[model samples]
Target chain A: MNPPLSRRDVLRRLGFVAGMWWAARAEARDIPGDSVYQLRAQLTDQDGRSFELSSLRGQAVLVSMFYSSCEQVCPMIFETIRLTLLALPVADRERVRVMMISFDPARDSVAVLKATAEAHQCDARWALLRAEDAEVRRIAAVLGVQYRRLASGEFNHSSAIELLDTEGRIAARTGTLGAADPGFVKAVRKALSRQA
Target chain B: MALEIVRRATRIVVCAAAACGTAMAADFITVPGGRFASVLPQGPVPTVSVPVEVAAFAMRATPVTAGEFLAFVRAHPEWQRGRAPAIFADRRYLVDWRSPVLLADGGAADRPVINVSWFAARAYCESERARLPTWLEWEYTAAADETRRDARADPQWRRRILSWYERPATTSPPRVGGAPNVFGVSDLHGVVWEWVDDFNALFIAGDSRVQGDPDTAKFCGAGALSVIDRDSYAVLMRIALLSSLSAADTTGSLGFRCVRPGGERP
Candidate 1:
């Protein structure tokens, strides 16, 4: 006859299984995409001030799509962005700003965005913004962003980042998850050269 | 639209086993040629040799005049606006998608259709199973110089070429005699910037060894293999030129010429 394990022992075993399950399911399905939306909508930040994306006439912007609650890719997305920003000499970094907007506007509040930014120790050059679902959809369509919902309150989405020059014209766009890819760096570098 | 003359030549493909022996002994009207030494190949190139060996193809001697592009519109009217090829609206194509120019050919039937993006040019070429020439091939076939004019040495030609820079964009291509390059290929240089299939392939400020990682010696721009004529005009020949324009850019200065595979023509 064998003795039963204690409550603490059962919880530890469950945690280990959950972690393994999460590990196995990393990099899951992709969101559907056909046409890219023509970027036109305006964006706002956690500070409550909004920047009309199309109106920011002469500033180069490095933009990505994300939500604060994401587990698999969003955090990794932030880290990737941080590294890319770090790679740029301070002069270039100051000239170019990074933007991340929450695709899941309903779930992510301004507070949530702030907390996420704080966790990453994000800088002034970077902004986390929130928007209405309809506006987000419009922006997404223009940027050709694709995202799908997950049962766990998260989402599966595309990893492309767009580079826009001072005139708000798209200088270059990379279909990569973040700044982690060398191709992303090269593309960004190329776009930066086109920047006025 | 009927103003310019393209000296339309029937497309001739000499390679087919059927045509090889019976092909006409074509006289390559080698006019006074120029020493575009830079245009010539150095060591070797990937797709084709450098100075471009355009075997010769049957092309409408004159460009598809403004009238030709116009008929394309009046017939398949639906294909005129939205259904038109993607390149027509490309920043490369100078044609305005919303308000296209009205030409004698309907709308630029004779006037070279400037402002055509590479995509638009490609779509036009593909609709008929043709394709745009590589830069080298286009230059080789069009450049005329039997009398041996050095493009750099001839002040008149040099000024004409530089006029493209710092000039307002216009749909009115240069007059036939005025725009032709040193080669007899009319409007090769100044009328409007022409489209090529491999649009993003090179950069004036770039190097060929771009596939590898960032080694200081590699992409660091130190002694980057100078493209043939690096000593002459700087930006016009720069590989990274396209990288400078907006993706939505379309100006009257842009146009295109076509090339076929194996340098053959139908």
Candidate 2:
């Protein structure tokens, strides 16, 4: 006693399914073999927007890891990255994006991340993201960042700015804090130029 | 006809018992956690020993065998030898398998499955609703003997573990049937090297061979982590091997098992 689905209805359902399949395939195709986008980490930015690390693929990214509570080295890490970006030509700088992942996800909630972003004056191009502990370890492994939490609830970490090309491959990295490493800045510029 | 029916009933009961035994064999053993001394010292000073507090968890009784891993790959074709991406596993991953989905010949089913990258091992654990044990968890569980919980202090036990490392790597590894330790977990030693979740975190530096100050440039906050307990050679060797590997790197001896937090299982 049920009416048969019309031909038009059948075609519409098939097309919708096919559209979803194609979108997934297209996203996968955008990632390359050597790219760190292969991590497939789920992250939430300062604004509470959930996104995949691979979503940052089409732009040159300056990526690093930090926790908000750290007083000394973490603040220096932010300043160093800012100075490095400033070293770039205005036109090249406008095209670059910056991402800082939190190694301490337990404490860095969305609100804390948002507060930190505002305090640091991170612009629209900057994303302060947090992910689960396992994902944090994976990202740290890929980025060559080392950190260890101590009994006192403070983390002893190495701070560095890693420049990822449009394809998410680490083009260069600099551990020089409190100042911008000129060589790393030049590599960032080259990456931007190639993308353009 | 009556006798035949009884015979069939007996066979069915026997088959059911065997299946139950297999399920029991794969059951995880609970490990009670406590503050314990680790081979790797915690603080900046090498001699200053720090006690690491481990949380209670359950660990697989034995390392995952080839048969178990084959079933995992069959159920999850994406993890098939030839199908997994190079970014997740290298060329040597499951290379000894006869085909992408089949195990090699000669009854190697019970042997521990090696040549697995960290990412592949993680996926396998995830499928079982488990995860790879953290380094501290693995270390705490490993510091046991057949009867005693903390057996690292026994020089004889330390030598026994060290001897396994000295065994030539050329020989084919034995099946996963080693004697259970105090926690009823088996094959923590005298088996393939297991992959811990934080293998990459073992950052041992102070190698004089490097040309420039690569440690300072490569690592950020604290300079470099040198081995604290120089006397604990076995643990130090593990740190060296783990530090040398990347997440995607797979070796012939590297395999893994899964763990679950206490009271998390149904």
Candidate 3:
């Protein structure tokens, strides 16, 4: 019978294995410790273009989660974003992008997302996105957005707009709706001005 | 010298094979799903109560052990303690482990793996072709005792479960196997707080919006969870704890299990 392996020997072997694995895989650039972009969630936009959430890096982004069917606060989220952007200078607003991900991917298809975008008059800078249920959950988790599907087919969700800095770090968040949150707008302006 | 080199190479190969071979051998017991009266309402209105329809699923009979997690990190090096991204896990993640791939001692292997972030737990489950159980599924399965499937109604049973919460924290918890519930699951309580797939979805009781409270204004749409059963203090405490955590946050007493779909409904 073979001799029993010691802890040192096992660790040595494991270290070698790990070393080989890391060597074989190309190391990606380091994202900030607090950056939400570290979450590699696959998302599809209103245009049906599939992209990773991290691809939105290099721009101050306003991110939120809402289902298109939500009549009350979901629409208000769009209006609030618009109002928040309006509060910023046009140049700063041009640099800032909005990412609205739907937690209800089952019903929020590409066509549905596009229509919602049109209804909200969302321009090219705004991305109305949908992801798989698990991905949606992870995105929500990272953004601190809470949402759950109800029996009535409507979603019971927290409406918080998170501001991701140029590096995708959460710089500011606001849950106020029906109008722009002044503090959140100030944070957005600060984020954009810093990036500028 | 040649013979010694050959033995070392042979040992490495054998050790690698053994670790990879046993990684996926966890025991999964089926918990039949049905209409469950969850503490958190399934409606937009916090006060209104509704039953959630949970599908049948298979769950790990016990929480993921440290030994099992060691094998997992060996297979998927990206999820190792130091290698995992900071956005996915906080500094306390897997802090108890002596090394990224080694448990502190032999006894550490059998103890339920704690200080694991929700993201890390979810990754481990994904590697096994399973996912973390939903809050509803976990609550439903945990409501069972050794004899009855829904022993939550009994005051003595509630007290017994609550006592686990009251006990002082043990730095070295015992091995995972305990009395199995009606679903053949063990250590759902008195072991560790677990990570649910929808942990972030659990809105807290304090999320109730007040007219002038700025912090309360942070949530839209009946975001607060109005507890339907206040008597289930143990279960309600679990909800509160889970609702308070972020995806990257990990605590010493928190661990998790995985669940697969298509379990036979009883």
Candidate with top DockQ is 2
TM-score for each model = 0.43, 0.86, 0.86
Candidate 1 ranges with C-alpha deviation above 4 Å: A1-196, B1-62, B74-79, B82-108, B149-156, B163-171, B175-184, B206-225, B234-248, B262-265
Task: Report the C-alpha displacement of residue B191, candidate 3, in angstroms.
Answer: 0.7
State the lDDT of candidate 2 residue by residue for A1-196, as single tens digits: 9899999999999999999999999888767666889888899999999978887787899999989998767888889888988998988877889999998899999999999999998999999999998889888877777677655566656777899999888899887887889999999988888885
Candidate 1 per-residue lDDT over residues A1-196, each given as its tens digit: 8789999989999999999888656412111111121233555677767755544445567787888766656776677777776777677776667778888788777777778889998888778887876467445544545544433455546656777665445567765444456665666666567667
Q: How would you encode candidate 2's per-residue C-alpha lDDT over B182-249 as one tens digit per residue?
A: 99999999888889888877776655233234354455444455555566778777778877788778
For TM-score, candidate 1 versus 3, the one ahead is 3
**lDDT winner, 2 or 3:** 3
Q: Which lDDT tens digits does candidate 3 get at residues B166-194?
A: 89998856689999999999999999999
| Candidate 3, pairs of clashing residues | none
What does fnat come to for each candidate? 0.00, 0.35, 0.61
Give the runs in model 2 whose Cα sits over 4 Å from its true position. A1-21, B1-25, B42-47, B205-226, B263-266
lDDT of 2: 0.82
Residue-level lDDT for B59 in candidate 1: 30
TM-score of chain A of each: 0.70, 0.89, 0.84
